[model samples]
Target: MALKLRLKPCERVVINGCVVQNENRRYTLTISNFAQIIRGSDILQEEDAVTPVRRAYFLIQSMLLDPTIAANGSGAAAEMMAQLYTTFTRPDIQDRIARAMGHIGERDYYKALSALRPVMEYEGTLLSPAPSASAPSFQTEGLDLHAGHHAGG
Candidate 1:
């Protein structure tokens, strides 16, 4: 299979750890061989990796850049995931982590990264400051409101 990329002017991509930039015009490239490729849009900056999920994404991205360090990267990601498991008990977060783990087990950093993407957005939601008195609660939704002896008993 081939990976086709259509980049805009001044766009950049990381191909097998090398950063390549397009000129001031549209450019297209078809990659025929298996190579690690990450577009600028998907790149996570070190400074921006503040949350646990972001840090995991960054580590996996590093694996994409340098496949040789996958073991170290996986270890770091696993440590972070352990902490995250205790911190976030939501079903959705758990599901995403499980999926990412499967991909990681296969040494498919790209798919692992994709699996974590939703968890990243979820982390943002979890961390977003509550501005009002009626802020959202992190507790399992219906378990609090409907799962009780009070509702039916």
Candidate 2:
């Protein structure tokens, strides 16, 4: 099946490890064969990869964007993935990461990226502090509650 892509003006896409930017106008493209493709929005910047899972994601992104890295057999991506596997013990996250690894091994970078999305989101939840149970809820009982209502009433 062919993939149909409709790109906005000036939008960029990485196809087969090459960065291609759209012209000043919107354009549509149809890809008929097997190729690596990533939209600009989905690309992860290096500085944005602050956590272990993010780092792993960045590595995977790098592999997909750069053919040399993917061809040279760099173990860095695998090493980082292994570290993440050890750090995250949740069965669901582990499964996603493992599936991503399988996709990587199969050279299916897009599928690997899809599998890693939930793992990254789960990592974010784990790293973020949970809302405090004792936090006070906002109440409109006391101050100026009638003042605003009177103007509209």
Model 2 gets an lDDT of: 0.86
Which runs in model 2 stand beyond 4 Å of their true positions? Answer: 23-27, 133-153
Identify the candidate with maximal lDDT: 2
Q: Model 1 Cα displacement at 69 (Å)?
A: 2.4
Best by TM-score: 2
Candidate 1 C-alpha lDDT tens digits along 46-138: 999998789889988888888677756787777877776677788888888888877777877777788888889988988998689887678
Clashes of 2: 0
Backbone clash numbers for all candidates listed: 0, 0
Residue pairs in steric clash, candidate 1? Answer: none
Residue 56 in candidate 1 has what lDDT?
83
